[model samples]
Target: MDPRQLARSSVPRSLPEARHLRQDDRFLLVTSIMPKNPAAVAHGPMLIGVTINVLLMGVIVMQAYEYFTSYKRRDDRYLKSLVVFVFCANILNTGFAVADVYLALINHFGDVQYLTVSTWLFVTDPVIVGTVACSVQMFFAWRVQVLTGRWYLGLLTASLALGQLICAMLMAWKCHQYPAWADFVKFTDLIIAWMTTTILVDVTITIILVWYLRRHKTGLEGTDQVVDRLIRLTVQTGMLTSVWALLDLVLFLTQPTDASHLIFQIPMVKMYTNSLMSSLNSRPKPKVFSEVTDNIHSIAKFVNHRTTMQDGTMQFASSLHPEAAAHLERHELGEFQKKTIEAASSGCKGDAKTGWDNAARAI
Candidate 1:
């Protein structure tokens, strides 16, 4: 008769049939309610990267604290200022990164159109990263010159550092021009150049430092040990940044559409700052040489020398023989003095007597 009665008649009459129909409806509803966005492919990696970046920032803060507190009086003013500038830059970059993700995922939730494009905050990452990388690289370049006395090596390193910064800035501009994440592929050449220069600078610095240290190694165990430690630190810090940059490039090239590269890219800046801090903090402590100084003083009795203490500074004088002064000058002790002064200027603090002993034994 009526349409309503006819529709009711079509329903399953048995309890088992009705239960199956209910289960089918439930399955359909669940499937329809599932999110359609490719969140796992695009956003998951970003969240993970940000988390890691924050963790590393904590480490940087701790290192910065140690540097400031322990080396405040000893470190040069310019070097301390550099650390402060780098630390501030890192904080700014991290803030920009957090804002970038927050605006896209949290603030604009369910807005698929907004997530497709990056904001200005997202582009600041490259600029800030470039700044920090250039600063640290240039510092190392100066170190290279100081250690090797070759201006060309320092100039080459500085040039490469500047090149990478230029590439990074260009990449940032390109990102600003094409805000859509999909269009990042358009700047493939820029990405390649930027990462390539970064790796080149790192490798160049590492080679120069390691070569100089190895060449200057003295036969004495104490001096050679110092040189070996420097070599190891140089390799570890330099290769770490290079390998990470290479990995970021590889991931971007291989999976251009996916956001997997963000994982390495976000944390890359921290690696530079950490490496610099590690190098600055690795200098030998004065307390480590107390026993060595005692032994050295005991041996000094046999050499017929006079030591004068003035203003808390020890001065070794050849009072018994004027020829001893000429003999010391003939031994090229100036080179050793230059190195010691360089170390002190670079914020490395150590016992003066111990350094003298090491230098004398090497000679």
Candidate 2:
């Protein structure tokens, strides 16, 4: 210690030989400050995740580019706009998460950062990511409504999105003022409970959506082939997101605070990057004329509207296939296609080639 400096405080510096004293002033004289434990520090690289985030950012930019391309080409305006909006929100959320990690890294408190990002980032940043994430969920459901022209799934999706947003925000608020929430549990347990609930619900909801898409009417003869592909991509993206959610919850719940969070969170970020990939590939496919009416009526009659064809549109014949009976019995388009094809086959109206004769020609 400097002599003049020590004189102002009237504390003598402890030399190597005299450093054994256990007194508080003696301790202060020996070392001016005590640092947090080294065990909590984040260190070393986790290449897999960092690499993935790098790729995801690339994908987000690409999706935005694709959306613009579709509009420039005068393709389907609705799907293009949907893609742009979803991708934009994803990029914003991902940026905030990545930035939060970087801030923790540069703050020189890697240990604290490693164990408490859910608190540090979740609580402090006003939670734009949660908003975006739930919006993406609502988008998934809304697209289904667009295809079926029914509002049942859209309403359900909207409700779930709202619920998720509330829970995420509540947890963030609890962390922001831990004192206000009253330190109700051990820090580790508290965080684990929060993570478990959030991730589980997210995963379950994603699984249900994927299942719904797989069973929906989409095929060359049944539904738009293009829409089917988009549905699949959305489900796949949702499934991947669920996987990350589970992993994040488990790790944060099980691992000690001193564990290398950089090692894991980067991977968590990577897992999260799939939203960008899904968004970029989300453009609507080229339309094929094949149609099946009422994909969701089979699940449950959420809406009770009578099915009818428009006045100017051509109504087709039903098929002999077993699927035809169910299609005709339930919805107007199914009967129209079955009859349209039948007449074409029986040599009564349009040629078979233009009608059901080549149902396989669907895009």
Question: Which has the greatest lDDT?
Answer: 1
Tens-digit per-residue lDDT, 1-363, candidate 1: 332232334444443444454544644443344343435455667777888889999999999988877667656678889999999998998888888788867877756557777788878989988989999999899887756668999999999999999998998999999988788988899999999999999999999988867765434454445567777889999999999999999999998767799898888899999999898777533344454444333334422244455664445443312112111212232354444333322321355445445533432
Q: Give me the overall lDDT of model 1.
A: 0.72
Each model's C-alpha lDDT? 0.72, 0.45
Model 2 CA deviation exceeding 4 Å by range? 1-18, 21-55, 71-126, 146-150, 179-235, 256-273, 276-349, 352-363
Which prediction has the highest TM-score against the true structure? 1
Q: Residue 102 CA error for candidate 1 (Å)?
A: 1.8
Model 2's alpha-carbon lDDT is 0.45
Cα error of candidate 1 at position 341, Å = 10
lDDT of 2 by residue, 194-232 (tens): 445445545555555455545544233333343355456
- TM-score for each predicted model, relative to the true structure: 0.74, 0.55
Ten-residue region with minimum lDDT total, candidate 1: 320-329
TM-score of 2: 0.55
